[model samples]
Target: MGSVLVIGSFNVDHVWTSDRLPRPGETLSGRYSSGPGGKGFNQAVAARRAGAATRFVCALGGDGGGDLARALAADDGIDLRELRSEAPTGTAGIYLDEAGGNSIVIGAGANADLSAAFVTAQAGAFAEAAVVLTQLESPAAAVLEGLRRARAAGAVALLNPAPANAAVAADLLAATDILTPNETEFTGLLARSTGTRVADDAIAATPDDRLHDWCRALLPHGIVVITLGGAGCFVSHADDARRGEEAACYRLPAAPARVVDTTGAGDAFNGALAAGLTQAPAAPFAQHVRLATHYAALSTERAGAAAAMPSAAQLRERFGELFSAG
Candidate 1:
């Protein structure tokens, strides 16, 4: 199998599940739970369980959170490369509604300490990777460095411009080979890239050609995959680089699934997509997206973040007829 290298953050997620999300200053009683999360770590675990040899690089503090990260990485068989930091490990507070919608607040402690130099130093990992995946959870400089090195090594550089508010520069956009963004994030990027504001709620209704135009403008030379929740996902590619796909842009419906918790669903998609790309380099790009969609839909059936990701065997067993072996 092929390998994937992930550069991002690891957080101890504190979650509260309630019948409905609270309004400002309105107190509500709910059930509390905690577990491993962080966009980077979630994707790393997803990629590994999706059947890729995965490597995760991040920064961690000398705390219980850090210990949890290390122990979980070991359990998942991910090659962990972390930098020690004096700051506390990162954390997130998440609130989940009965419908599985979530709102999160992050405390980016040691995650802010991931440096460009540290990312650049992992040349060996970058060199051996078939795909190098990263997100904005870490410092922008560090994320940019990882993407650059992935490009230099001829690995497919995948960027998930998540959390909606993370500042992504033109250089970072230019360096990415594949860009995955949910509706909110795509709107944020569109506003930043072309000064055009399409509300997140309107993304699913936007015309494919119009969406393709915005996607092309955002990353002129790369592929853009916009995940649109229950509406499924939209894929846009440069005319010259369709990755053997017949259409320059297309939409795929989400697989059938019973929803529970929506947290980490996007991470599941991204990780499974990376696994498919690495293990089946010659398959049509849509095939990878299909696997990602199925995997993501399956993830929502469970709770938590990293712990919610389903294994490749489980994916096939659940959607075997829909997702053939890569």
Candidate 2:
């Protein structure tokens, strides 16, 4: 299979599970655990377990967290290209409620140290990639450089603008081929890029045509995927580039899943989507989206972030025979 290259961060995550989220200045007792996470690492693990040949590129500190990252990558058979950093490893504190919702705070240490020069040095790896998936957790210059190289290599350049607060420039997004944003991130992008404000909660209820217009405005030359969590997902493609789909815009219902934790659902979607693209390049775009939604749903059935990603076999087992075709 062709490779999926993921360029981003690696954060060791500390988690707390409670019956409900804590209010301001509120402290509640909850179960505690720590593990390997970070959007980039979570997605990389997801892709690898989804049966793709994957590579993860990031910066790591000379610490136990970094060692954990390296060990995990090796265990998963992911080709890891990590730069050593003087800064400490990144970390995240995640608070998960009983309802499967979560709030996260990140300490971007070595993650912030990933440089454009490091990304540029991965030209050979980029050349072998079929899909290059990246997020905004790392430095913008490094992320932008990865996207630019992906375009130059003729690989599918997929961008996930997460955190809903990252400062993304127009030129950085100009190089993207597929832009995936959850509802909140979509709202933020729309407001920042087009000066249009559509409340995130109202996105699913908005007219399909209107959402398509907003998506076009966000990425005029590319495709836009707005993941609406339990409400399902929406897809909008540029008229000129439908990527083998019959419709320019459409929606897919959420796949069934028993809820546990949702910390890595978005990462699962992006990673599985990348895997599907490489594994089934000739399939209709909708088919890939189906695989991603199902994969993501299955991920929610488990707990933790990177540890929560389900494998291809598990996905097929949960969703039935449909996934066998993937």
How well does candidate 2 match the true structure in TM-score terms? Answer: 0.99
In candidate 1, list every pair of residues with a backbone clash: none
TM-scores for all predictions:
0.98, 0.99
Top candidate by lDDT = 1
Tens digit of per-residue lDDT, candidate 1, span 48-93: 9999999999999999999999999999999999999999999999
List ranges where model 1 is wrong by over 4 Å: 321-325
Query: Candidate 2 residues 59-129, lDDT tens each?
Result: 99999999999999999999999999999999999999999999999999999999999999998899999
Residue 107 lDDT in model 2? 98
lDDT of each: 0.95, 0.94
Mark the 10 consecutive residues where model 2 has the least summed lDDT: 317-326
> Model 2: how far is 114 from its true place, Å?
0.4
Q: Any idea what lDDT model 1 has?
A: 0.95
lDDT of 2 at 53: 94
Off by over 4 Å in 2: none
